[model samples]
Target chain A: MMTARAAFAAVAFAALALPASAITVVVADGAPEIALRVGATGGTISQVSFAVAAATAGTGTLILGTTNAAAGSAQAPNFGTACAGNNVRIWARARSTAFSPRTATLTVNGSGNLTSGANTIPLTNFGWVTSGGTEIASGNFTGSPTQALLSFGTTREVSVCKRFQFLNTTIYPSGTYTGQVTYSLQMP
Target chain B: MNPTRLLASLALGAAILATAGPVHAEQPATDTTAPFAVNARLNFRLTYPRFLRFRVGATGATVNLMSFTVPAGNVGSGTPVAPTGGDAGGGTGVNVLVYGNNGQVTITATNSSGGLGIGTATASDGRINYNQISSVSSSGQLPAPVLTNAGGTTALPTLNSTLVTQRTAVWTYSYLNQTIPSAGTYGGTNASRGGRVTYTATMP
Candidate 1:
């Protein structure tokens, strides 16, 4: 009788093992989510002007002019009033949590021309000088027609500062000149 | 196939379902690629001056200083006085209207003859010698005038750092009253002796 009980116990263990195969093991995730934070948008670059009277003669590039009197002298606007800490701040991050590497790149596009009536000023006349804490390389828009602003091997956060610099000039038509620069961030 | 065999099969199926837990919790892997976008734009504008008008008196047609008594003497030397201000004279002040959207205007003065002249009696004699009569002090609306030189180039800040609206620059004249020329009406319509001092406007 004891021998018969041991054989029945073996049969029950085999039946449990058969059901184990029927149990499906499935792994899943909630959903793929990402986040990007860039400072204020819309006319991100401020309005700039030049005064011919105060402008000094320069051989290379044209810049905003300086003057003795406060009236109508050409000087760079205080960009900080509008931007974070007076400089452009760009930040981005992702939460794959899957340990998957993600990429984010920044690109700029525009005619690179500042216009007033028929007059035009090239975008190259001005530049972006990196300031304060920065993760990306320091360079100007003329060189960065399309370049990587930031990238990461995993989830990360970063911040940077950018200041706009104008070249000194002697000549350019007497008019209000304007130009545009576009920044695009892409992630996949 | 007896009742005991059927019961054993049913028990195995029940255990499998129980161990599986919530069926909805398990989800198959899906497409993981997603592209997101954000835009940054730049908009700037400038409104240049519509017309840069220089006028004398309270207002009137633009005119040059005319009809002055020639100092006596062949060498053009006399204790004669300087030319007086006009209705729109620098003494009274002239209005320079710079219509624009932003900032100041840079003004420069240049003479074609190198000096104020009537083809014969040159203000600089042969160079740029002319004084600007202005009421506003350097510390005021306009900077001190840098008188024109013999080379037709005047000192900068001719009207340096002027506001976008309208301001006055008065006018009067003093010439080296020496070596008076052959007496005749020095100027008339389209006379070459009527040297012109060109004023240019630009944003610095």
Candidate 2:
């Protein structure tokens, strides 16, 4: 009886050993997102700052969009007056995740427009800079929101800035101009 | 290999395995910046006041034609005089001065019978027997006159041009008290023979 019991116990031990033989890998899924805070509104004479944190792992795309559809480089609530200095800037920091250096694409929606009622300040007024620190592209917003604005092949900071310039001030009327913008970070 | 020791060892190993990494693999972790609202604002304003005026002479003063009596023997005769900024009646001519933009002055006979009738016209009540007599000049200002002697509704000349600035127009009047039956008072009241000429100025 004792001999029989020992054999049965050995069989049970083998079953448990099978699962323990494999290694366990601890991992964390994506976490809840943190908010990007832009402390103040933009204006004709001054520029504003906006910042976002780096991703934990993997490659992703960052998208920026606007509600108005005006066709110029200056974003909406347009410096309707065509004042001397107006603009926007965006920047990204170097990635801390060195092992999985994944490429990041920065894109802006063509629909990005700054609008006040029926009036709009265009998205083309904005420009982008890569981690190397030079303007890669400049001009008006395109016809689609899915348009690519910039690409990051390495883990580095990137930026975009806008400068609205108007040589003539005689055409604009006096009134309050106002509008809104949206952003997205996506991976596929 | 005691039974109790064997059972205890197995239980401990099971607990260790349970405390290890997740049994099911999870997707690679991702970090994102939440969506945010962007906004912007601007401010604007303008002012101008109201004005208009018209006079009948170089003195820039309004004038009323003075009353005058003609002898019965001169009933069929006509008279003409230059209006020198005064109420001197009997065919006195007057200079008209107007200052205003985009406005016109229209003169019409407002009498029930329309205007002075032609002495020989078949119908006697609606015609004015008169002529433009004289004007400053065609170059100074264009004159539009509908003055006639045939009996009918009479709307005198009208300055149809829109005035961009102040302007002056001058003209002489010739009055003929044609043989129209009774030689009663022939001026002043709108209903009387020659009656009054109503000048209306409008701007839009």
Candidate 3:
């Protein structure tokens, strides 16, 4: 009687292992956004800062964005803004039971903002980004935000909306973040 | 797992809201104002005056001398001669003296209108001296007549001019010799019987 019961308990254990061992992977899709988008009233956007990029969180490989890319430099950057190359970046991370969680920060610098033929503002980054130490490749943030107007013609405040895709660079995975971004005058 | 505590934070009592995306906060609203304005005016003033004078003419004038000498010795002679017509003493009653004759005589003559100064005379004593006499008269109607001492008491203004009228002289000489001088020198037997008379003229 005890041997029969042992076999039955083993069967119950295998059943529980069926679902748990199915090799599940929780994926954090692209969660990119345009926040604190700013510009002048009635004045055109002679330029814009493609400052923020997409973030991704998942149980598998997770990354902020391309490094040494034309959008962002390969290394850390200076926080101050200039009339030239912007210091814009994107970051993402991920975690799992068998792998370590990783985090990265990417940047996307562009030639301000200009309207495309689609009657929308498209970020014009010329595959050129500068940081504290290096230049990088081009097409780093392989996605773009949904074009929208960020202008206030006669009032003090304005509203804008944006979205983007996420991409991974390494095998790093599972990192989530709640944004605490600060917006300040770069070079008023 | 939460970033701070991993598995414990993941197990915390909280609900996980699901969606296809996360929303971000936008930039704060700001104000922008309009520009300024402008506008202006101008003005001026002025003043002035003129200058001028007054004037009149160079109209005309005249001068004169009327009859100032008359005849003595011969009345009606029209020459400056002695008054010898009525009572002889050559009618001047002077016996050739100028002021008084056998008595004092005063002679007065006027122009065509009877005035005071065409001629004058006063005789007395013996021979006619004919020194003191009167002036001439003048008028706005005619040119004054000028006379000259034409040898002795005969005064002719324009000594060659024709006579305009006959002269008349009053004589008191009749009292002297009571008539003509009983001498052969009375004109028809004259040796030189005329005497002098003086005359003067002046401007006002």
C-alpha lDDT score of every prediction, in listed order: 0.43, 0.34, 0.22
**Candidate 2, B179: how far from true, in Å?**
5.2
Question: Candidate 3 on A71-137: residue-level lDDT in tens?
Answer: 2212111111222132333211122223332222222223232332222222221222323222123
- Point out the higher-scoring one by DockQ: 1 or 3: 1
Q: How displaced is residue B173 in candidate 3, in Å?
A: 99
Q: For residues A90-113, could you state the per-residue lDDT of candidate 2 as single tens digits?
A: 332223234544444444454554
Best by DockQ: 1
Provide DockQ values for all models, in the order shown: 0.14, 0.02, 0.01
State which candidate has the highest TM-score.
1
Please state what fraction of the native interface contacts candidate 3 reproduces.
Answer: 0.02
Candidate 1 DockQ vs. native: 0.14
Sort by TM-score, top down from the best: 1, 2, 3
Ranking by DockQ: 1, 2, 3
Task: List the RMSD of every prediction in angstroms.
Answer: 23.7, 28.0, 57.1
**C-alpha displacement of A151 in model 2, angstroms?**
62
TM-score of each: 0.38, 0.28, 0.15
Write model 1 residue lDDT over A1-188, tens digit each, in one string: 99999999987865543311011111122244333333333222333344333323233444432211111111111111223233444443343556465655556654467787666667655655554444566665564565456654334434444545555332344566766665555566
Candidate 3 residue spans exceeding 4 A from truth: A1-86, A89-99, A102-126, A133-188, B1-20, B26-204
Tell how far residue A46 is off in model 3, in angstroms.
Answer: 15
Better of 1 and 2 by DockQ: 1
- Model 2 TM-score, all chains together: 0.28
